[model samples]
Target chain A: AQSVAQPEDQVNVAEGNPLTVKCTYSVSGNPYLFWYVQYPNRGLQFLLKYITGDNLVKGSYGFEAEFNKSQTSFHLKKPSALVSDSALYFCAVTPGTYKYIFGTGTRLKVLA
Target chain B: DAGVTQSPTHLIKTRGQHVTLRCSPISGHKSVSWYQQVLGQGPQFIFQYYEKEERGRGNFPDRFSARQFPNYSSELNVNALLLGDSALYLCASSASRQAFSYEQYFGPGTRLTVT
Candidate 1:
């Protein structure tokens, strides 16, 4: 079965510091990984997706993800964090099943 | 262009009751997908329809069903609802004709609460 794992339930980082939300996926075929952010009471907003391109994929709101095939990881990273960047983040993988399997989610807290 | 849209921002129901949720895809989008997002969890795939035909379905029970209209609008119907069914229902749309696999645009989602 294809699945994704978000190791951290919550991540705490001071504003202006780098932030990382870790994710690892398991898939039989090529992994179609993506990142999404969700604010309270709001729907998910797509951040970035790693289809078949450069390992480092840049996305909205100054976000980027590194797709590591060896580690089976697609970690979301930001050079500098902001208070507004604090939200729930999810990692998903779309495999051959034509369905998406999402991670449990990581709550990113950017302290100001 | 307008993004995907869903109706009934919030709803409250009880066990054994039936509920219907609606979604309108973006103009020119022929594919629509439904997801269930419980609190503190990720969204789970429910169904996907293209050109008003079912393309894929998740592991959800028969109590959860959906259909797409000729206009590309879709409806999700859940019967004999349980507290477990309480969650935010999200609708996503994509242009399937161009690429079979592409990122989907999501809507604000409908929050459902069961008592």
Candidate 2:
């Protein structure tokens, strides 16, 4: 079985400061990782994904994630945070299949 | 192109009642999947259908069932709904061969409330 974990229930950061949302995974085979963001009363928006190659995957809205195989982690990051960037972040993983196991989300609050 | 679209954006039902949620996938897509997102929780995979065939199912019980039409549109049906079933039901669609990935495009979701 494959699973994902977002250790922090919530994260707070100041505007213009860098932000990081942590994620880890457990899979029997090579993993495909993804990050999604959800705002108030909306569905998820894909941020980035780590399928293979290029440990640093850049995605929509000035966000990026590093795929660390050894650490079994794929952490979403932004160089600078914006108030609009505040949303719920989710980490999902699939083990060479269509079954996606998602983390229990981490709410991000970017204080203006 | 339009993203995945779900109908009855908001629905209210009571326990013991059955409900149906619908989804229309993006054009040119052949796969659709259903997920349940409870408040303060990540989306949970429920079902996946391709080419109008059921492909995969999650840990959900038999009361939860779904099907995909020829056009790749899908419907999820829940029998004997419980309060625990109250959540945002999301539908996602992906191309048959997205190549090296199963990237899914999500719908705005149908918010189902069981009172």
Candidate 3:
């Protein structure tokens, strides 16, 4: 039963400020993590993924995530947030099972 | 190349009725997956089809079924729909079944509302 947990339901940050969205996972084997962003009335867009090797993975839209194996966490971060960055963020974990378990999702609100 | 596409961007159905959602995978993509996303919740896996065959199924009931055509297009059929079934139906496509780690291109999704 591999699962992902996104503790926050919503995160508010001012524009130009650094932002972080927390994510943690539980899996039996090696975990392949991913981050996706969904805009209003649009499909999900892939941001980044962590399969192996690097613990710090960079993604699109200046997003990056750190995969902590011992802590079972992969947190999404950005150096500076923008108003356009407001969207729904989802963290997912795949254990090479061809199926992904997604977190509940965290709504990011970037104020200008 | 165009990304994944879904037909009928919006659909409304009544209780106990049946609805079919269609999805066209990206060009050259061989794997298609279906998901149900309720308002304010993350997408839930429904089914996965590859090479015109069923590769995986979620915990959904038998009332929900799906199939993939030779062209890599797929359809999800739900019978006796309930209000709880009202959600956005999402379709995602990948190059291969083994390429699970790769990013999946998602369609705009079909908003299904069960009254």
Best DockQ among the predictions, by candidate number: 3
Measured against the native two-chain assembly using Cα atoms, what DockQ does each of the candidate structures obtain, in the order listed?
0.59, 0.61, 0.80
- The C-alpha stretches of model 2 lying farther than 4 A from their native spots are B97-100
**Model 1, C-alpha of A40: deviation from truth (Å):** 0.8
Model 2: per-residue Cα lDDT at residue B47: 88
For model 3, state the Cα shift of residue A4 in Å: 0.7
For model 3, the DockQ equals 0.80
What C-alpha lDDT do the candidate models reach, one value each?
A: 0.91, 0.91, 0.94
Model 2 clashing-pair count: 0
- Alpha-carbon deviation at A45 in model 3, angstroms: 0.5
Top-scoring candidate (lDDT):
3
Interface RMSD of each: 2.2, 2.0, 0.9
State the lDDT of candidate 2 residue by residue for B13-88, as single tens digits.
Answer: 9999999999999999999989999988889999888888877888999999999888889999999999999999
The Cα error of candidate 1 at residue B25, in Å, is 1.1
Deviation of model 3 at A85, angstroms:
0.7
lDDT string for model 3 (B1-115, tens) is 8899999999999999999999999999999999999998999999999999999988999999999999999999999999999999999999978746888889999999999
Shift of residue A22 alpha carbon in model 1, Å: 0.6
lDDT of 3 by residue, A1-112 (tens): 6789999999999999999999999999899999999999999999999999989999998999999999999999999999999999999998887787899999999999
* Tens digit per residue, CA lDDT, model 2, A1-112: 5789999999999999999999999999888899989888888888889989999999999999999999999999999999999989999998877688999999999999
